[model samples]
Target: MKRFHVHVVVPRLDESVRFYSSMFGAEPSVLKDDYAKWMLEDPRMNFAISARGGEVGVNHLGFQVDSDEELTALREQVVAGSVVVQDQPGAQCCYANSNKYWAQDPAGVPWETYHTLGGIPMFGADSRESAAPDAGGACCAPVTSIPAVIEKKVGCC
Candidate 1:
C-alpha cells in the first residue's frame, strides 16, 4: 500500500499544530520540537509540518510505501527517466528511520518516495546543515546526485 504525502514548513509551530490538528480532526501521530506528522488513515494522507525550514510554505511532496519491494519499484520508476534520482537506504529523519529515494519534478519541486522502517529517538542523523535548502536538514536531505541550479549569464550589448 502507498500513502500520499505532503510536507510543509510553518513559521509558528504551536499555532500551526493546533490549526492542523483541528483541521484534520486529530492530533499528530509524531510530534517533535521542530516537526509534527499526522498519519491520517481516514483521509489516507500523510501530512507533516516542520519549523526547521528557511521559508514558511509547502516544503515538498512524497509517497510512503509499505514495503521494500514497493520502494524499489518506486525508485526504479523514477530512475528509468532522465531525471537524476538519489537513493538513501536506512536514512533517519523526522523522528523515524526510513529508506527513501528522492527526485525533482521538472519545475524543481522536490519529490520523495520512501518506506518507513521504524521510529527513532531523534529528528535525524545529519550533524551538518542540508545543502539542499528546499530539502530540510535530515536524512531526507537530497544527496550528491542532486542537480545544482544553473545560472544563465546575461551580457548587456
Candidate 2:
C-alpha cells in the first residue's frame, strides 16, 4: 500500500506533539530535539514536523519509495515532463539523510523523492539555497471546491 506523508513546520514542538498525540491516541514513533514523526497505522501516513523558519503550516508532502528502482523511475518521469528537478542525496533533512529527488508541480509545493539512508541533522549539508534549484512556484494543488464531496459523504451515522 502507498502511504501519504505530510511534513509540517511547528513553532512549538511540545504543543504540536500534545495535539497530535491526543488526536491520534498514540505518541510519535520517533522524537528528536527539533523534530517528531508519527507513523500512524490507521490512516497510514508519516506525519512529521521540523523547525523551519516559517508560519506554522505544511512544510512539504512526499510519497514513500520502496526501493532505489522506484525512486529512479519517479525521477525519470518528472525529468521527462517537468521543467525543474531538485536532487539531494543522503544529507540531513528533517533529521534523516535520505536519498531523494525534489520537484514542484504546477503549484509550487515541493515534492520530495527520498529513501532514508541514515540519521542526520540536515539535508544537503553543504549546498546553501543559493546553489539549490529555484523553487518552481507555489508547491502543490489548490482546493478548487468548498463543501468537498468527501465531506458530504462522511458523517456520524
**Top model by lDDT, which number?**
1
Candidate RMSDs in order: 7.2, 10.1
For candidate 2, write residues 1-157 as lDDT tens digits.
4456777777888889889899889998888766678877788888886543444577567776667788788778878885466565553445555676665556556566666666654422434322441321121111122122211111000
Segments in model 1 whose C-alpha atoms lie over 4 Å from true places: 129-139, 149-157
Cα lDDT for residue 92, model 2? 48
Tens digit per residue, CA lDDT, model 1, 10-104: 89899999999999999998888888999999879899888875556777788999999999987887778777887778777777778887777
Task: Point out the worst 10-residue segment of candidate 2 by lDDT.
Answer: 148-157
Residue 145's lDDT in candidate 2: 24
Q: Each candidate's TM vs. the true structure?
A: 0.85, 0.71
lDDT per model vs. reference: 0.72, 0.57
TM-score of 2: 0.71
Model 1 residue pairs with clashes:
none
How many angstroms is residue 111 displaced in model 1 relative to the true structure, after the best TM-score fit? 0.5
